[model samples]
Target: MAGTGPQVARSPLELLNNQAAAEPPLLVKHAGPVIFSVVGFIAAAGANWATRRPLLSGVHRYVLIVGGSMAAGIYVEKKRAEHLATRDAMFRHYIELHPEDFPPYERKQFKDLFQEWIPIR
Candidate 1:
């Protein structure tokens, strides 16, 4: 919760903390092929006692390609979502506290500012 009452303002720290709580856990749980590929590459070099050349080489390529893409995609999506949510929250807070400060052009500017805050998906 940010704050109580209609006139109360949410502090920046409070907003951030509330946002953090509302957001999903930061970890990328399923790393796809990336994990297996890196491990396989290391193993292929015979660094581990259990290393097997054929298995390592066979899996390495697929894991590197598929898993790396999946992981990168997930990361980008999470970042974009966080940015948009923060922008939306800030915009709402501004409008609530300063309803009379905006002209039509300033409203457009706010919309533009919100869009600018997030990277294009």
Candidate 2:
């Protein structure tokens, strides 16, 4: 004999864990920020030491500003790439699940538009 029971709803933690398992990890996610932060700090510290002044003074200020800007740009680009990848994956899955919703012409158009982000299969 076997017992039968209704399915139980997943808790928030379980859902999060499942989602994390399903999604592909982005290498740039943590690498970009950590690398940028370390580089910026080192540059600032070196500039301050060489000039014997605070980071806000002279060349040190410029170095810190440039490093910060570069870091921000890298982070933004990485996030954008991740977002685009996720969107493209969802779009492909949706197309597979509901082929009727997308006509051949429209599918081709979408594929062409995202050719850079998504590889044609």
Candidate 3:
């Protein structure tokens, strides 16, 4: 006997698979390695010069030391700013709810409870 029910439609997953199969490969697949190779060469050259011995023996050493320290200091400052922003956002929410100081013990308790629900690393 012929089928009694209506024909079922294709699900979204099937339609998506068909669409994906029709498209060309990603641009990055063809261009990524070429870009990476060029960048790697540039980075290697820069590192080599930054580390190489100088006409004056101590000059190269001093430059490398100062440059590295400055880079590290900038990176640390950026990270500290990001961390403070995150901490402030977390505390701002609490201050909005309670104007008075939240005790250290209570703050810890709240932090632990909140983190347990939605952990942040």
Estimated TM-score for each candidate? 0.36, 0.40, 0.34
Residue pairs with backbone overlap in model 1:
none
- Give model 3's TM-score versus the native structure: 0.34
Better candidate number, 1 or 3, judged by TM-score:
1
lDDT of 3 by residue, 51-115 (tens): 89333455454455555555655566567669977876666666556745543232235556554
**lDDT for each residue of candidate 1 in 1-121, tens digit (9 for 90 to 100):** 6654333223433443343444344454444334544554554445333553454355555556556666666676677779988887887678667757643331234566564466678
Q: By summed lDDT, which 10 consecutive residues of candidate 3 come out lowest?
A: 9-18
Please rank every candidate by lDDT, starting with the best. 2, 1, 3
Model 2 agreement with the true structure over 8-108: per-residue lDDT tens digits: 32332232223344344676445666566667667776877787887556765666656785678687777887997787677667666776765443223
Query: What is the Cα-based TM-score of model 2?
Result: 0.40
True-structure lDDT of candidate 3: 0.51
Pairs of residues clashing in candidate 3 = none
Instruction: List the global CA lDDT of all models.
Output: 0.53, 0.61, 0.51
